[model samples]
Target: MSAEAPARPVGSPRRPGVKMALLAFCMLVFSVDYNIVYVALPEIGREVGFSAQSLQWVVSAYSVGLGGALLLGGRAVDRLGARRMLVLALALYALASTAGGLATEPGLLVAARVVQGLGGALLFPATLSLINTGFEEGPVRNRAYAVWGTAGASGAIIGSLVGGLLTDYLGWAWVFFVNVPLCVLAVAGCYAWLAPDARSGDSRAFDVHGALLATAASTLLVYGLINGPEAGWSSARTLTTIAVGLVLGVAFFAVEAKAADPLAPPRLFGYRGLLTAMLIIFVFQGAINTLHYLFFIQLQDVLGYSPLEAGLAFLPMSAVAMLGSGKLLPAVVKRWGVRGALFSGLTGVGASMIVLSLTMSTDTGFLPLLPAVLLWGLFAGMIYPAMFMAAGSDAAPDEQGVASGLTQTSAQIGGAVGMALLIAVANAGLDLNEGAANSVGDVVDGLRLSALTGGIAAVAGAFLAFRIKPPRAARQDGSATEAPPEPETVHSA
Candidate 1:
């Protein structure tokens, strides 16, 4: 058994609230970047003289960088330290954002985005591990996750609005420039507020071979998924890339099984709650991304709303999400426990998707979609925090970083795959070659079909939520009776 590190002094005077706020802001920045460039895409393509087909590399580069490096980032947090990784990540974001804003050519901007994604890969798991390790388990941890989730959920909506406003007022470059000041502020705040990471003496070797294979596999998989929808799915390039990724993935597991100190220790997957939470996160992220993509299409293409108008239309739903996640979700978890809350949230989201599908029409406006949108916000708010809370339910301190990485990796892959499949469902009968010739009615039908498919997946997730087994140290009232002891080995279920 590995020797446990000495505990920190009891009743230390660190201010958790301030630290939490800083962490939440970091999450907000990461989430905002995911979609902020979308509104600026057309302007960017025109300014950089990108070919229509090649323009997508701006977004895909980030996805590829982030998806590929997440496992490495998570493992680094454990080997290095969260504070160290956090500062490094923010620095990368600052430098990359500056480069992106100043880029005169398409290749430069795309390269900048890929660097920004690498920064996010480091930032996300580091921030999450800090949250999971800093807060006490149960209610305190749950509430912290609520605050974190609220920021993250709201950022996606806010990104579009901010992107549209900035792209219109200050130009597309400002969208990238905006992140610089925020990243600098966050870096300053991290140093001022966060407690210094405790030094550890453990000398376990990192599995470099395993890390390379895993990164390569993830990069190829995400690249293929992102490319498959645009390039023909059956294209030889897509098929070959995806097949190679799967082979590398299989090889990664085989390497890890023999390594003395694996990059991703197999034991991390032994916890039933963590496994269940990862599954739920996968489905939840996928469904939510599908809903958001379809909604944007409906608002812009079908209803003919301007970018700004469509961005503004999300205000009500975003407001509801923030309120529900910050205040209501904790109470729900206390009353019903994590499992119950997750089940309820998934069911609600599933039903909301079905209702949303029914309401979407070429003749409809934003008002017609409000009820289902609000319903989605309320329920989705509950799911995000609960899923994370469940992920950390029984994790040891040393394992928190990789555990966070696992959940996030699941979310990233799930979102890509989910969006691709659901989008294919939505575009079923429409010939892209036909373009404007495909009637609005046909497009609406396709979107409705995709939404219904997402709804079915959510319902399936609701059923799977029951598989999570709460830790023995947790009370039925959603508070920890005591901190769980470090386990010598995480036994398989």
Candidate 2:
């Protein structure tokens, strides 16, 4: 494999529609895998003999693995070909899922999940890079992203539902077993449909030091954030871990500055809308994940809904989100542009959160939650694809993988931070030490406070959305143009 391969005829795939569908399907599989385990965690703990505290490793291990490997995966996608990386990622998923399904102990299942997450790190960047590089910018790429976003949103909701059904009827193992066939199909489809990588003779060296630093920083940072709430925010262990991660992050940047071939070139940050896009994604992801966490707690703890019922409760919002992604997002982007669409979406999400704060109560039924749920879905559809579109807006074809990686990294970190902070806020004034039960009123109040905080964060994200400037050609001529040559050095955006 070579670093500078001749570009493989960008935007010229045969049966592009089918290719887009396959890519979207891959996204769906990853999304489903992410959430499906949540509903099965209790079953997994009981069967695998996991203690209450250690059971969280089942989820945190995956997060740590995905967060750590994303930069490396993205670099690989650019160095190797998207099709090759996609096949490799899907194969990993298939193998890991099988291992997970057959695991008789907690350690094996957790290890399998970590491998699955590493696979996701590769799959996400590869899928997004293919979309960005395969379709022409503007309407074609926007639509492709919308379809991809629809799959992601729908798959998440479906995961919860499927997990509940599988865990109850078939067993928790089925949750892992299910991914095997889907991954195999995706791998087969990739071989049959995706074009081969362009041949290259250039053999630029890989940035080993930069990759190691970035991976270590990401993994440690995510680990600390995920455990901070449980370990106490001011705890020495959590603070020390986060501090070390930050130090490593700074070291990674310094190494990148000097590397012959940096894993993540600093120049990528100079693209017009890229940094702002990353910021918006960070905030948007944080807000969305916090909202989901709060609602999950509310539905099950406050409203006394069963796992299956709680899963069913999300259907309306998921349906609307999918509908908006498929039908409304393109039109919104066409009329208002990416910035406007993001602004509108973030604002809507904020308003929805505030409304949820006011409406949710122990005495209330699901009907009162509908207004906020529908509002979140309608706007979230716009935000999901718009942020990615913005990130890819002026990125060169060869850099799409790393560009996608940067935003995805932001998303992972943001989700962790948001969950940690908001969950802490939600648990305020409540004694959660070793089985202390909170009253319904106290829980409701905490939920309201957390939702309010999430709403404020979303509004801040909407303001940041305006910071995304139009692409250079669009601003100059009011028309889109192809991306310019990559800059020789990093420059201020």
Candidate 3:
């Protein structure tokens, strides 16, 4: 009875699972590089004289570059085709990793990291876009995303362990080298599994103005935050960076508001639940990442664990993170609703951090910190995926990539900001100690201060949990039907 042939449902990509694994593997590489390097910093410093301030660059550079590019990367994939961009990104990743490994000078290594970050910025979002493209809508997409989310969390744990083994025995360079193989494998495997998806030419134009303003603002803000306490909070450079960052941020918003195709859609934030969820996630991701930095540094430096020993110390946290995130998260959400899980996770994480603040001692055994770490890991596992799911819950199908990008951008920027703030707090009120362990007392004090910041942030997250709505079932009987008013938009349950 129809005048025209039935409109086609978009064809699913061939061998989606293989493509998903390749993407997951790339995420593992980047995350491991990020988390693993923090633990290995002392070794790096000892090998080549690294001032405390200089050492922070090793971590911050990656964040700066990666955070700077993620938004545009999402847009780029949408236009350029996910497959093409992903291959290019992987090539860049391998090149940077190789360069990073070969560098002897700190400046060179840091520069390599900036390049590596660029590759990651492109790679991650493209991969996420591919996943959203490949998976069928509803339970299939949710489960695919859940698995994607789990790999990233588990990868952090895995990275720390692998990085420790590599750094301890093989040297820190090996940590970077490991990525090269994975990059090759990922590209080759992806070639076999992931063909190009349906292309939309709408995403073509690069937003140079948006990218520069956003990157400048993020970098300046981070630099100011990290440098301020040490440089005198009111120092000219510190003050200038923050001031310029504010101006750039204002410009960025203006540019987006007027641009025909904005990097960030203004209406996206109108989804009240998604916006709040992003903020809460930003706060907690920082809280969680910084704690890993504190715990491992203490374990190895004060408790006199070898890299191997430190790796062992973190095993339980990884295990708990896996159990909680992989197995418990979806089930919990199924029963309690999104708000309930968000509240439970925030409360648990905050309480756990508070409990951890009590457990700090340079000489304390791992047993003393076990319960706190376990709780921290479980809560973190619960928090991340729920928020990730929340971000796209109401997003239009075509816009899922953008939704994922904003969610990750919030995560990266939050991580950089929160980390700088917490570390500044740790650096505050410290008496200089010449020892590598830096006076066990100073270390303990810093850990406590960092934990305090995280605990406080988590407490705030609890109050924000009420904003999220539970997921709804997708419509089944397919047609050129109207897009449902994104099920989770204002869901009560």
* TM-score: the better of candidates 1 and 2: 2
What tens-digit string does per-residue lDDT give for candidate 2 at 1-493?
A: 2325433345346798998999999999998999888888888999998998889888888888898889889988988878899999999999999999999998998899999999999999999989877875557778899999999888977898899999999999999999999998998888887887776665998888998999999999999998887787799999999999999999999999988899998887776577888888788888888898888788998888887788888878887888778878888888778888889889999999999999989889899999999999888876888888888776777778888888888888998998888888888868898888888999999999999999988897798877666444455642232456322101112
lDDT tens digits by residue: candidate 3, 9-49: 24344555665566677666666766767567777767656
In terms of TM-score, which candidate is stronger, 1 or 3? 1
- Scored by lDDT, the top model is 2
What is the lDDT of every predicted structure here? 0.83, 0.85, 0.72
Worst 10 residues of 2 by lDDT: 484-493
Off by over 4 Å in 1: 1-13, 434-436, 470-493
- Kindly list the per-residue Cα lDDT of model 1 for residues 1-493, writing each as its tens digit: 3235434321112787887898999999997887788888889999987888889888889988898999888889878888899999999998999999999999899999999989998999888888777765556667788999899878867787899999999999998999999898999998888877777887777889998998999889999988997788999989999999999999999998889999887877777667888898889888998898898899999999887787788777777888778887888888878888889898888988999999999899889899999999988887887887777765666677777778878887888888898999999889788345889999999999999999988988898887775433343423231235533121111
User: Which ten residues in a row are the worst by lDDT in model 3?
Assistant: 473-482
Report lDDT (Cα) of residue 218, candidate 2.
Answer: 95
* Per-model TM-score versus the true fold: 0.92, 0.94, 0.87
Better of 1 and 2 by lDDT: 2
Identify the candidate with maximal TM-score. 2
